[model samples]
Target: MPIELKMPALSPTMEEGTLAKWLVKEGDSVSSGDLLAEIETDKATMEFEAVDEGVITKLLVAEGTDGVKVGTVIAVIAGEDDDSASAPKTAPAAPKAEVAAPPPPAAAPVASTPAPAPATASGDERIKASPLARRIAAERAVDLSQISGSGPNGRIVKQDVEAAIGGASAAPAAPPAASAPQAAPAPKPAPVAAIETDIPHEVVKLSNMRKTIARRLTESKQQVPHIYLTVDVRLDALLKLRSELNASLESRGVKLSVNDMLVKALALSLIQVPKCNVSFAGDTMLQYSRADISVAVSVPTGLITPIVKGADSKTLSVISTEISELAGRAKEGKLQPHEYQGGTASISNMGMMGIKQFEAVINPPQGMILAIGAGEKRPYIVDDALAIATVMSATGSFDHRAIDGADGAELMKVFKELVEKPLGLVA
Candidate 1:
């Protein structure tokens, strides 16, 4: 049998991706784990590998094809012993009888559900559930093993898990079902007004990265209740410490940036005020023990946050080196999924760009993000007298649903203290 190679979901949030390039062509012999293609997701370009030894029969999707949906057949691979000439040249269509099969068969019995459950429930074995279905199951604590698949070849899918959940909930003491009155239909939204222009302009299509960014940020602003807290922190002491450390560390080729110090300070601050280092999960709050800071780096495509894991415990030099490497790879779109996926908190520094204070949208799951502005010479109170000092406005955007105003303030206070003190970050 010829096996169909579908577009793999490179990331958890990936629904579709561009077929950037094909490394193998029809009639090419390949072994398991051989590089098959390069797929460009919303975040980065990832290499897809062959799962079975086979001879490529046909390429269904051409290179550079955008928005190829996940699970859409991209190519066909015939078995090692199979003749390539006899392999299917296209995706095999289902028979009319199979297409006409009724939905009642899927709901037949709970025993049928177990047929697909073994693939996922076999201890420590990889599950063959769809990404969305897996996420839904995780969030609902519904065991994947108990659900029967209704998708292709007994593959567990979203509808199957949902149906299983509904069945289970209904199994508990059946309530007298009453037909509730249907609410009035919602009114259609007003169409967006088109912009009038006399000058000729090009209609540039948005890239996958830009589209994902737009969608995620819009959702963050709309769904997350954000509370912004700004504080002016004197950076003179931190700057002095950085210079001194750089001079001493010059022999080792290690130079620390202010952003590196900021990452450390934020991590320690989160450690001091654990309430601020949290994620807003519906009906629950996730309090993290380690402070992993996602530092925002602007790539050509868009912005990406590569995380600095355990920043609180790492030395400033280590944080500086790791961030440098991560940011470089991030800009090149070479970061792996794990490098930019999850973080306890985030820090977005536009200080180097010389931007003044500006509020940032909160990244979902993360409760807070520290936005750092340029440090400029300004009037400061020293011993009750006005003096010159380098001051920078740092704003902390918090998810009000997850972090209280007081806790957010406390985290900011601690951050300022660590930065001004300049020794706690290194110690």
Candidate 2:
């Protein structure tokens, strides 16, 4: 019997995912746990591992095709040695599977004649419009060729149409329509001022991750009462330790970064404050024994948060290595959902970008998120004497509904202790 490869649920909030790429093509032999397709969920691009040993008979969902709901048939695998030459080729042709695939995009409308265009000033000349404008006009049922162009290329601009249709520059408006319905209707107003314009914009569809982020963040802001607690930690010793460690390990290929140390410190802090390592269920908060910290990475499409599992148990070196790998993959959009999700908490660090401090939205299910800032030289009063010190400010955004202000304060204190004394984190 053949088995279906349904779109795996990548994140708790993922409803559908994009088929980013397929590691195994049709007819390729696959084994249980074998790497299959690379799926792009709402958060990250992740590997879709096979669960059954068989041959990839067909791919119902092709690469770049998206909006596949969770558990929908993404591919089909035939039993060992079974020929799959007759399997369906496209999603539309696939037999009924567990989860239903979305209907195909509607066909383009056929025109009886070539699309009508605005009359250009030149005889028999067609309107000069940007490609995007042309497409937008088609979609909005606007007659682009009819509008006059004010652009350098004599192209029809959005404002041009608005101007043609009673913009500020439009001729003096005629009397009210009710009063002058019989008289010639007033000419459309043109823009009064020379309105500055930009190149027509393009509308790119949102990726799964962006859509989910928008939806979840919007909901979090609307539903979760968020409270922020901030603390500036003096990182003189940590920076000095990191420099020494990097110098010693230069040959061993283990140079450490402030962000890496921060990740390690956050992990250790979680151990002391396990309450911070929890997710809010409807009535109660569920805590986890292990500390997995998801670090946010920015990509071309949007942000991806890849988790460093067992972070508390891992040494600084291990954490650094895993974090580098995960970050690289995140930029390439190659992370698996598990690699990005399943974290008890998250860290959004913008220190490298010279950000002094910032707050981050809480990635759902998780009760806490730490926003990191850049290290800077500042004056500090030590023992009544003012001295310059390098300190990095960090803010923890807690779900007030789950974590109390005192608890948040305690967690920040623990984090300060571990990071200020870098040895504690490594030891």
Candidate 3:
């Protein structure tokens, strides 16, 4: 019996996918777990593997085709030596021969294969259509190559077409003759070029992921009574600790970043201020006993937040290891839906991207999101004297319906102390 090769669900929310390319042709023998095609979903480009070993007998969809729903049969594989199960045999010699040959000479041009003609429309029957013309035609839904030219050598020149469409030509002036040179005289005042005003034009279709982002963000902003609290932390000690940790862990293939430390800090702070870690549920608020911190990781397709569950209970080293694996899997689109969704609190770090400070939108169901910015060297009062220090800014967005401004500020105080002191986090 022939086996159907259906489009596998790359991610939980992925419904339809685009078949980017096929690795094997029809009739090629394939093994189970072999890469068969590359599929593009709303999240990432993933390699779809063949689940059954057999000869590829049919391909229902071509490459670059989109809107193929998940579980749709895309291809078929026939069992070995089963003539009845195999695809109907068809002669492929003629198409192969045509593909193998070099194009014919221009003297005897074939009508089947169209060649580009000159662009100038002289008195001849030909029309001159430039490559730009052909591109414009494809974009504007015009058939330039198909149109019969009224100009020289079947050329569809710009002016002739404009005239045919009842439009005037803003023809360019010809350059001066190269054979005759003019003498240099007094310089004339050069006219300033008119600046083109930027027209506010925006009508592109929204991508599936973008549409989801829009809907979720709108709901979050409208329903959640948002209040923001900002705090500045000294990062000199934290930076030293990270360097020492990374130096020791380098040989073990574990890289500990400041963001990793922040994850731990947030988790520890959440444990102290349990109220800040709660999420609002309709008329009631639910406070989680365990701290699940969702760290936002940017993938090629879009942003995804993967959770590190029970982060408050786990040591910093464990958080580092788990986050590394989670980020790696997230980039490859190997993360399960549950692995990314359903966190008690979240963190969005733009510090690495050179962002000084920025606010973040709340993820649905989560009452708070911490926005972190880059550290910069500045003068600060030390022992009643000004001294150089490294400081970083952080903003906490809390749901007013669940958390108050004073309560959020208190939580920030604990988080700030944990990050600035650095040694206390381990202690």
lDDT per model vs. reference: 0.76, 0.70, 0.68
Q: TM-scores of all models? A: 0.77, 0.66, 0.63
Tens-place lDDT digits, model 3, residues 104-216: 33221122122244443453234345343344445556545445432223434332233223211111100111111121121333444855658976665544455556656
Candidate 1 lDDT, 1-427, residue by residue in tens: 7877766655534566888999998889986556888899888887776656789888877788786766666788889777677776445443222222342222213222223343655552355566667777889998887775544345566555665665453321111011100121123334448888989998777778888788778767777799999999999999999999999989989999999999999999999999998776666666777888899999988999988888888999999999999999998888766567667789999988899798999877678999999999999997799999999999999999989999999999999999999998878
Q: Which candidate is the best by lDDT?
A: 1
TM-score of 2: 0.66
Q: Taking the candidates one at a time, how many backbone clashes does each contain?
A: 1, 18, 14
RMSD of each: 9.9, 23.1, 24.4
Model 2 lDDT, full chain set: 0.70
Q: Write the per-residue lDDT of candidate 2 for residues 243-313, one digit (tens) a residue.
A: 88889878979878888889888888888998776666655556677777889888988888887877888
Cα deviation of 69, candidate 3, in Å: 2.2
